[model samples]
Target: MSTPSPTMPPWPAESDHASGWSLVRAAAAAAEAAAAANRPARYALVAATGLLRELAPEEEGGLLAWEPGTGWRCLLPPQDCRQAVADLYLPLCAAHAARPITVAHLGQSLDGFIATGGGDSYYVTGPANILHLHRLRALCDAVVVGAETVLTDNPRLTARLATGPNPLRVVLDPSRRLPATHHVFSDGAASTVRACLAPNAAFTPGAADLVVAERGGRLDLADLVRQLRARGCSRIFIEGGGVTVSAFLQAGLLDRLQVAIASLLIGEGRPALMLPGREPLAHCVRPAARLFRMGEDILYDCDLAASTAAPAAAAPNGQSLQRLF
Candidate 1:
């Protein structure tokens, strides 16, 4: 990837002696500037943490820092401001520290259904989770979904409720079945990309820019990611319709996965994820997860890479659920 622009905002100066609320403000300012410039906030936060240490040695642990040996490490205690700082910086930090962070998100009912039998899913989770998804879109460079989701939901896929700029909307439509009249296609709020298996003569171009990456009549997701990265979309958010999310999970391309589980149950409907079955329980994929209460819903934030390396532990909310293998 090309170097970020020199015109991008610089980190807080050490000489400023920022502390307490000022430190928080500085970190927030740096994050906002990075987002505005379309640059990774992690780099700026790294510099900001150094300044934080210089300003207030006692508060050094609170500022998000990156260690070469252990990756992103945060020593902050539980506090509202600290949590807020972490909420803003952690995603960017994780994205920048990794090769390319691909997070898949899903909002489903308690029984793991994403929609009703007829595909009528107005809101599975609460408003808080919806806002959280929008925030995730704001953090990511691109937001992706399957063409089936586009046809079923007709979502606008914009960062409307969030503060940051809208992400590039990506649709994986191997067969080019999605209509040009889809809201995502006609919406000019953000740039759109339509990745298909090949250039079809029958398909008419619309607001979306078309890209073809075919491999045995299938859209090569790895190639698609490379193309997106080439276009400066390093971090991707997969907002899915089951199959798309499952494909990425089975391919081991997803770094993080967030699922919002609502209180209600849809007894019969679309399943959230569909992976191949393993004969033995030990052979199943088990990711380390943390749970949080978002309004009436419970949010599961999982770290796929950490699951293999660390033992499963109870979440901060003192609830533990078996990994959805």
Candidate 2:
């Protein structure tokens, strides 16, 4: 329910209305052109709006306008543009229509990761990225990590910014990596799910609701996706170490890769993207990609931008799907 702008000139002729792919294309073309030029798409929609002028419905109305990132939105009764993008993404993402998931990587040094080192592995990315990441978290429906990560790092697994309900916290404990005595079980009464290897394992009050099940070989991956989707999780964020990163990449299930490289890379510290074994790059993972920089590190945002040749899936220590989400 939006307030209609009385000042809006009525939509044009019936001949002008874009009801099918034609109209969608027009809107998308307009949006894309405008965004590319760093200009507003307002004028484009205005031009398209005239198509229905012929209809001149007794109650003239219909149209929506707003920037995607910035929520400056408005409606004139009948038309709503805010919902257009998702629709657009659907067709645009037909082959890759998994959902607009993003993996936010917080690279750390040997000293510590995310302000958290061996002794003090508190936080990895700084305030800015942390803020941005929280915003991302709020935008998503779920957050994930692997089990070993839980053993080592007792993360609250909660979105602390961009307030709203926190994303559901998920753990991929393939082998029941998290003991019933783990902190995740003791933390606030937050919504959490632990995917374990033993499907019928008895649960303790602390970790009673764990999703314990043995994933069948290559099928474990499918089960993971199905479980999350069943939870109504459309957008996922994987934020963790290397193993998971390599897993998703190798599986070719990884949709997007967003890695933030800190200015100070502990040259001698841990390696990022743990795919295991020194395989020849020619036979390893490949993805089509791009880069952006925030603060000191560069953000490598890849959309299957790596090599077409898949890498041999290897689960190394600290390497878990937790990183990809």
Candidate 3:
């Protein structure tokens, strides 16, 4: 979808005009009516006529719904809506509903570099994408990153730019090399999880809860996922420094992948994704991607699971081997 117009307001604004106030009152009334009827109501306010009218069944658009405690909420049609704002919320809601959905996101340059060779990745994308990341963190139950990201960026990983509770911070440090002085550890704004390969006896986490899931001196990604699931993290957002993201993708654990490409080109730097596979072109992943613009950056959302080839035929035993795609 095209980018939202620059002149459009971030949200509906209150104005001294009577028509604006009437629209607000109509919306409130519609929400209450929907709540009383135990169903959502759809209405559109015509600016020229200054009237709020119920949408017909054939009409194709989003609606404003009302919940008892929560006033009014926008309900957009996932497949029908062309609004750029819908691009952000629809995927997020879909992930939230799934059983432990995992999404990996990265902001890279035109040349596919996530950071400079020196590891200076600050402002790789525009300010809008940074806010978009915050929105993702707000929606997810947990946000994960690698030890190198923690050391290099020292990000707070909180939802400061968005409206919602901050998700739990997860640091994958197989060697426990990250220090306790990082902003994610010392910020105290959100709960943190430190997953390492070493046993509890070998190391102590600084300010975050410690989780040791080691198998052959490596942090088991599947085990880590189970731990997060046990903690009621239904949706996990993996924000990274290459290796961590690569590990998840290699494991075929990611449900969705969103890559935001910036306008500038960083000739040499850290790559965004690095899956090691020597499969032929036909066997390679070719997820159906959709594009959206977030300020100057172009966001590509890929559905990994759906885009993979279908499962092979079952064996003579009437059992099919489960595939991870």
> Which lDDT tens digits does candidate 1 get at residues 45-70?
34444333212434333455444333
Per-model TM against the reference:
0.75, 0.57, 0.71
Count: clashes, candidate 1: 0
RMSD of 3: 10.8
Q: How much lDDT does each candidate structure score?
A: 0.67, 0.49, 0.69
Task: Point out the worst 10-residue segment of candidate 2 by lDDT.
Answer: 88-97
lDDT of 3 by residue, 1-325 (tens): 4343332213221232223334443443343244455544566767676445667768866354444433355563433232345334444443322234798999999998899988999889988788779877877889999998988888999999765679899999776677788887777899887887654553334455556666667788888988888787877999997888888988888988999998888887988888777567668777766556566777888888668553324443353542211
Positional deviation of residue 246's Cα in model 1 after best superposition, in angstroms: 0.5
Question: How does candidate 3 score on lDDT?
Answer: 0.69
Tell me which residue pairs clash in candidate 1: none
Clashing pairs counted in every model: 0, 44, 0
C-alpha lDDT of residue 270 in model 2: 39
Measured by TM-score, the strongest candidate is 1
Worst 10 residues of 1 by lDDT: 4-13
Q: What is the lDDT of candidate 2?
A: 0.49
Worst 10 residues of 3 by lDDT: 8-17
